[model samples]
Target: MSKTSTPGQIRRLTKAHKMSFAAVATIGAAALAATLVPAGTADAGTTVAAAPVAWTQAVEGVQAKTVQHLSMQSKLATDAAKLEAAVKAKAAAAAAKAKADAEAAAKAKKDREAKAAASRSTVRKPVYANNLDGWIKESLAIMKAHKIPGTYNGLYKNIMRESSGNPRAINNWDINAQNGVPSKGLLQVIKPTFLAYHVPGTPLDQYHPVANIVAAANYAADRYGSIDNVNSAY
Candidate 1:
């Protein structure tokens, strides 16, 4: 309602008042002067001051800008939180997989070592004493492996009768010795019989107790069903 206001100036001021404070800069200084003074009245004794913005419009504009800024901040915070959660989940999954893989490798190595130990135990030879009982027991075990049937009592009885449990016993006056092959060892098995019926793991020497007993047992089982059946000069 300024007395110097032109219709165009009034329109621009009206538009500026409806907008924010920044919108006032769009109108030129001529429009501002026209709004403050009457047309062609510049020489009159009147004070020139800046235009006052409407308080309600200015407050409303500030409130709307504040709401927009808060909304943008909220959206950015939500996005950042989601990204952080995803990164943590990925890292946790990788750690779990690494732990599982390490455990599996450790278990696999333990199993391999166990299997190798078992194999070595299986392949290692059993030790036996150098006595009548040990030789008989070991020979019986060998006979069982070769499907040759005999008993501890039967082997002991035969060994006692043949060589009195002497591992180095040899019959020089026997028919076998006359033919240039002496009956030797605990069961008095000749060289031909000893070589032919010798179990693979025992020594080839007829003086070896277990070897001699195993050879004699093998021969006896083949000929008389078992060494247990041999009671006399077999």
Candidate 2:
């Protein structure tokens, strides 16, 4: 004979299966919660996922302004570098010009000095011995009467060498010639030298020959080393 299935037995078995299914669903829910939430935090006070904040036209405009500002700063920096390079180039050119000018001036000064030195070395002093022979003889006689040192021959040699015995000898052409300041007589006597060295009661005319020769000899003996070297070519 076939056995009949009972509803109470079947209902008991279904209830046990339902409990096992509920236990499995609870475990899966716990694993998913752990993956979503931070450790040590209760789900009752947990943060919910928020939606991203929307951007406005004003915000986008700020970003565009920042990009423009960076571009402007880059251009300004490049301009500053160019300006500095130009300034450096200008300074270098100015320095080079100054150096060249200084060198040119120095060369010109040196050349002028050299030319002057050469001129001084080659020029000769004036000589006038040929015309004053008679005047010299008379002057020598007067020097003897006064008892001045040295023979007539020695005096003649000295005077000839000194001024070439020229009565009107003048070394300075520029002043004496222009002003007509006569260096009169065989001794080349200026007015001052004549007054200072004049023989007493002698005529002030330096051309008197006798007076001038004595005065010249006195001046030469006093100022120069001697009549000997005065006659020699310097």
Candidate 3:
């Protein structure tokens, strides 16, 4: 005949994980109070050294296995998180360095272009003052371009003797003046000679210092070879 199962068997089943220990233990006590088993049957093989020992050992084994599984999972999760953080940190550092390098190259290019622009933008044309000295120098520069030969001293001496550095000086008693076109300007040239020999690019006005001097010098160069050779009136 079949009999109701005892607490010993339930404990053994709970230890082996066949069923939940909480559910089996709760119903085991009630079954024990209400059911009948032979007197010797319930505690007959129920010594502490019997199935209880095996049950305790089996439960401890399951707890050890559970703890091992949880520990392994925790370690794997921690390692993965650390590896991800390290990869992100390394990538961030590389990006920062690349940005710095790009900025430095851009600044260097700008500085080079600025320096080159400064070098290329320098003005080289000569600036002249508005005076007799400046005029003489200006005329000489113009003369050199036309290959005319004359010196500063040669021109200055003739100017002082002829008109005393006056641009509006006129001779009313001279033969050239008696004809109606008076000798005028720093070198005292009449209208006919001024117009004939006035250097190109200079003004046509006779009283203009550079025009008068340049015209007189041209006339002198034609007759005497150069103004520098004509120390006296030409």
Candidate 4:
């Protein structure tokens, strides 16, 4: 025995099958859209990925700024060091110049002192003895040269008796002095007598030892014959 279906029941079953197929097609379309689009551009509110060229340029800008800062710091340090070195060198040079000037001044002072000492030494004079014995000895030499005849003993005795060997002796209380003819020198010879018989080679000063002795000897020779003949003051 074969079974037969009614048209209304068959139509209702076909309609349910078509609805299930339409739901499967909607799911397939959503999956295909997800596969084709990028994840960065998936939604309107999502941020976009940066391009490779833009990222590289930002990194290079940061590096350049850092290098510039470092270079400026290095230049400042070098300049400071150079300034300090220059100041020290200038101070050292000033000290050296001051020392040189001081040494030159000291040398100049020393030279001046040496020259003054030499000048002083050059102008010094010699000293001679001023005594009776020295005067008598000098007179004797002059008398010998002038050919005046008198012995050392005769001259010494007369000088001792007349003025006690004082070359500057004056006989102000004597007979010759009373007559306005004062006797002077070692032998107490009057000025008139000394001038009358003044020796050519002797000093004209009556107080001089050589002049007195020679003049007195010449006068005694002419008046009393010789100095040896006189035993006391004439």
lDDT of each: 0.88, 0.68, 0.84, 0.82
Ranked candidates, highest lDDT first: 1, 3, 4, 2
Ranking by TM-score: 1, 3, 4, 2
Which consecutive 10 residues in model 2 have the weakest lDDT in total?
Answer: 225-234
- lDDT string for model 2 (1-234, tens) is 898779998999899999999999999877665665556665676665422234456678889999999999999999999999999999999999999999999999999999999888885634434445655565555555665444466567756654676656665563554576656665566767777877664567776666777777666656663333355422
TM-score for predicted model 2 compared with the true structure: 0.34
lDDT of 4: 0.82
Is 3 or 4 the stronger prediction by TM-score? 3
Count the clashes in each prediction.
2, 2, 0, 0
Runs in model 1 deviating more than 4 A are 1-97, 100-127
- True-structure lDDT of candidate 1: 0.88
TM-score, candidate number 3? 0.49
Q: Between 2 and 4, whose TM-score is larger?
A: 4
Of the pair 2 and 4, which is ahead by lDDT? 4
List model 4 lDDT by residue over 1-234, tens digit each: 888889988998899888888988998866665665676676866544444556679989999999999999999999999999999999999999999999999999999999999998895533325676666666666667777677778778888888898889998887898999999998888999999999886789999887887888888878887676778878
